[model samples]
Target chain A: MAIYGVALLAGCMMFGLIIGDLLGQVLGIEANLGGVGIAMLLLIFVTNVIHQWGKLPDSTSSGITFWNAMYIPIVVAMAASQNVAAAFSGGLVSLLAGVLAVVLGLALVPVIAGKPEPEQDCQDEPATAVASNTAGSRRG
Target chain B: MFESLIELFDEYHLIAAFAVIGLTMYLSNWLSVRFTNGKFHGSAIAILLGLLLAYIGGVVTGGENGLADLTLFSGLGLMGGGMLRDLAIIATAYGVRFSEIRKAGVHGVVALFAGVIVSFLAGGIIAVGFGYTDPVDITTVGAGTVTYIVGPVTGSTLGASSEIIALSIAAGLVKSILVMIVTPMTSRIIGLDNPRSAMIFGGLIGTTSGVAAGLAATDARLVPYGAMTATFYTGLGILLAPTALFLMVRAIA
Candidate 1:
């Protein structure tokens, strides 16, 4: 059953990579497109479909849960392989790109999120609640 | 006997590498709980430690592959290679439920698109600011801002040089680490207490590990919701980065 889960995952990965490769070729690019991400979508689709048919046994689902936690170690392996020195030596461009992306993204959070929900405690105090509500909506 | 044991480790370097990483994770988790009171997830610390080790490895070995350059740790290269990375990414999808994602509704969808475009523009504009004229290079770095995985995927597909690819990866790594560190601190201010907000946050952030760890630190219950959208962000980035986005960058700069 565990192997079945991995087998399913592997199958999805294969198809994903194939699609990625084809997409690259069609676009005249030399590298695979979002193979890993496609594989994830496939996995989600397959697993959802199967669950609809019947409940997947605990043992079967454990295979996936097992690998889910394994993501951390795998990512650590990735970090270990990265060339930090080379990137820093490359120029300030890399640093700037990274910092700017995150900063701008974080700033946009409020804009995308719009107004915050009214606090529960504010409801208890009628007078203060009106003032805070107005202030919150105005800021939003 | 000792020499043969050493040879065995060399031959099974991947296993040795796993052991080392396991130890690092354990220690990171311990540190997170003991010192940071779990406000910082173990994974972030582990990555920082990994990066530190990599820097030290590069300094010591003076080779391109970092710690893997040393024969004993050579397995780190393959362990960290594409095959496993892809597998890890896929495996993360196993537990995500579509029902929860649907609950995020239109806001979630909008957040995903907005997140990717904003990140791409930021990266591309910054790349331009830095004097990277080639559209391919600009797109690749921009894609990296989407996520480290997206960067290399975009870079290689667009025929970016190895140096540019490395920079993309670095840019992504920096973003991931920053998200992990900043999330908990900003959670209250951002009101990231609910699953809906977390999903939007994940979509906006667009880094699976970063969002997952950050949410884990802020509120463990929000992880799956956030992670699901974050996963989609990567897929969307992959689809756009090498195709439409690249073309737009070319036209602009």
Candidate 2:
């Protein structure tokens, strides 16, 4: 049932947070080492397995979708509580950080974006003509 | 009875923060719907409000933790802790399908690396300019350009000062807001109409909130495509910022 999938999702989330905490402890970072992201990956893999074997119910899939949609809004809401105080009071140092980022980001745009068409090796300009010729030759 | 009620509020100040945040969300959404025509999502506005509230709380109380410094709002410290943040991020994965990520291909992958490295360098250079000679501070700021999430992680790992870490987060936040505001305006010039283009854009920009919001405004259909790579961008940034990137920065500056 869909309820089972939701329960499984909760379990995965809890498990991920624990692992993330443990990872942070080991890494000595004092943060949650991408715990949510790991959990999401786990859920994606588990759900796929469930779907592949013809076991996942529509209800469960919907439940997953519902939670997925809520994730962003919740994340955005949570981000408001971030340490803006530090950023604001950090003074000219932080100001330079944003300025430099924008300058460098704009400069790199040309090199890093939308050049895949040049890398396309094959040219299939006349797909219809080639297909028609092949068909006619075969029939003849 | 009134004194007891006040005590109860002091005990559950977190609930007050929640109430305030919830109301802030509603007001933000209404403002978005009315003025910007939903161009700016409620999430962004809510953040603004929350920050304003925190600033007010800090000014009023002259406390260290902003609203958390107030006895009636201490819950915010825990509520805004890593636990909920991590949980929310995990939920974001539910919507993602791995196959979609694969469709971005080699170019998207390249963009991810380029995005992170270039952003990091930009940030590091600024940190250096600001007299932050320490590698930890430089690397943290540099990583901040990659994404907000990477900044704190790198800072904590390298033992950067709290102020520098905050600066990094600010740097990332500014990048995200800029990307969000600029993406829709430049979408046509950037050819961000297709799924592939969106993927590359996401990779290059690497701020999930900004990418998603910008894409939503530009073309709702492309949000998922863009956010996928953006999410991966965060993961990669986290992996690289403290270890490989930190070493590279140390060698250079």
Candidate 3:
């Protein structure tokens, strides 16, 4: 039943929140840390386990999808609720915060990805080719 | 009759909210398909539209809750509250495919943490650049660059002001849209043509919808791989941002 999916989600959320609260206490932070994230992890693990058992019926999967589809509306609602006018008038901080995020994130992609395996075979030829080209250009 | 109709809308304001949002989505999606040819996702457009409406709502009412300040749209306050927002975020985990993650291997895993750290630090640095000295404000905005959800979640936890939280969300939304638009264009340059690369990309990018849509445009086959790691990225972001990352920011700033 679809309700089963919701029940599972709710259970995971509760468990995650409790654990998060405990973790917060241990860390001496007054706020809950990672409760929503922990809950999502629990749900993923639980759903995968159920799928492995072959007990995850279509009904249950659909149940999850039904709510998952609500992602768009929820996000839109959130945007609607945000006070961007106030944020904008506050300063250039928000715009800078966003622009820097994308630029810095894209710059680090190559650094994080390193070298792809298949490209290694062809790497030597391009390396020498580019090296010679650059050397010739510098001399000219 | 008019009074009764108004009463009905008030009583069923939640439903009214759904109707209004539904209409907005329809219009946004229509514009997306008709004009942008789906290069931009409908949801992104809808979000932009929502932000615009919110600005107008705030200007019209001079109140704090944006569109929720309006009597007709008051239900948006509850609909957009932390409860439903978290629920929507948690629901995303339900769609994850476990087998797909194994293909990305070690780099995929590393990318997830790296993506979160880099994105968090980028946000934090910019927060500092803007003269925000409080660790709570800095951390919250930094987390927002990770993902919109992470921003508000971290913000509320740290007791950041509403203005800061809103900025954090905006920062995230901008990052998400940029990823969605830029990924496809840079695919060839970055070698994002393969599933493994896509996974790594997702891990580095960290926004699920953005990575998913971006991968979808680049290569439909790679969506699952990219989205799988991206999903984990959000979870990891939530876990690290508020606790470890926040502490680091607190120490540094």
Candidate 4:
């Protein structure tokens, strides 16, 4: 049944929340661990395991998709609560460091990729841009 | 009638906040598609609008919790709590197909480790420069450089102070917002049109929200590939920050 996805999500969420609470209790902190990350990891592992067993029907996948779409917009609301003001008011050094890390990451992208400035708009040159890694290149 | 309506507002504030947000999103999207000519994504615009609204709410109410501190918008605190934020991340990751992810190859693995370490190092160095000589504080904020969630988690586990933890979260959130807003603008300069590049890009920038939204704006097809590596990146950060990174900080501090 398509409802299987929701069932899987519910199960994962339950376990994740339990684990998060347990971790918080164990550490004596007022915060839970990454229950959602744990839940997502569980879903990924379970679905992959089901696929390996030849039991992952298409309907359940569709069900997961449905929830994903309906849920993503909630991200904006989450960003609203982020502590941007605190980051700024914390210290000039902290703010400088945050900006510096982002800049360093951005600057490292081209160096790590071994690509040049990509000046001419690579949208028209997609084939030439990524020729090194053909689809068959295996990690294993 | 007005006094009674105020009571009703207090009762359904959460639902009302959701409606107001929805309306705001539509306007942001319209502005993005029209004025920016698709240069700025609707999500990015919505985020900017959200920040502006939060700042105004803080100023008007003279209270913490931003808009949520107001009686009519109290539901936002619950709506924007950790549970939903984490769920949104998980749901997005659940939508990925494994086949596409496998194609990232050895480059993807390298990127993951590199992203976590580089981000952490950058953060740690900055913390020390700010006169945070304590290893615990440095490591907590350093972990936050890897991702916002990892920062506080590391802090709580390591028993860092709340002030340092808040700084860590702020650092992490700053990274996330930057990743979200900047990825689109710099995509081409960094060769971000392919999955391999996307995977590498994902590894280099470990903030999941930033990578997801940035990749979505740059190219929707690349979101899953970038997000997959990013998910792994966060897990690695969580595992390393409190232990390995802390030890490194301890030695240096």
The best candidate in terms of DockQ: 1
Q: Model 2 over residues B1-253: C-alpha lDDT tens digits?
A: 9788768877777677667567767898899899989877666566556556656666767654555666666766656555554444444455455644454557677877887888888888877876888888889989887787899988887898887777788788767656655666677776676656666777778777667556654655565556556656776788789999999888986
Query: Interface RMSD for each candidate model?
Result: 5.8, 7.7, 8.5, 4.6
Supply every candidate's count of residue pairs whose N, Cα or C atoms clash at under 3 angstroms.
0, 3, 0, 0
Q: For residues B117-223, what per-residue lDDT tens digits would candidate 4 score against the true structure?
A: 88888888898887888889889888888887889989999999998888888788778777766887888888777667777888889787677667755665565
Task: Report the lDDT tens digits of candidate 1 across residue range B131-222.
Answer: 88999999999998888888998998889999889888878877776676677778778767665677788889987767755765565556
lDDT of 3 by residue, A1-140 (tens): 97888788778878977887787678655545557656876888898888789898888777667766776676677667766565455456666766677677666666765654432334234453334222322321
Would you estimate the TM-scores of all the predictions? 0.73, 0.68, 0.67, 0.75
CA error at residue B233 for candidate 4, angstroms: 3.8
What C-alpha lDDT values do all the predictions have? 0.74, 0.66, 0.72, 0.70
Q: After superposition, how far is residue B251 of candidate 1 from its true place, in Å?
A: 6.3
- Model 3: colliding residue pairs: none
What DockQ does each prediction reach against the true complex? Answer: 0.32, 0.22, 0.26, 0.29
Q: Is the docking of candidate 4 incorrect, acceptable, medium or high quality?
A: acceptable
Ranking by DockQ: 1, 4, 3, 2
Of candidates 3 and 2, the better by TM-score: 2
Runs of candidate 1 exceeding 4 Å displacement: A19-38, A52-55, A113-140, B1-6, B105-109, B127-173, B180-188, B191-202, B207-253
> With candidate 1 superimposed using the best TM-score fit, by how many Å does residue B112's alpha carbon deviate from the native?
4.3
Local error of candidate 4 at A61, Å? 6.0
TM-score of chain B of 3: 0.65
Q: Output the better candidate (1/3) by lDDT.
A: 1
For residues A4-117, could you state the per-residue lDDT of candidate 4 as single tens digits? 876777788778778866765675544454455456667777877888899878888777776566443455565555554555555655566577778888777777767522
Error of 1 at B97 (Å): 2.2
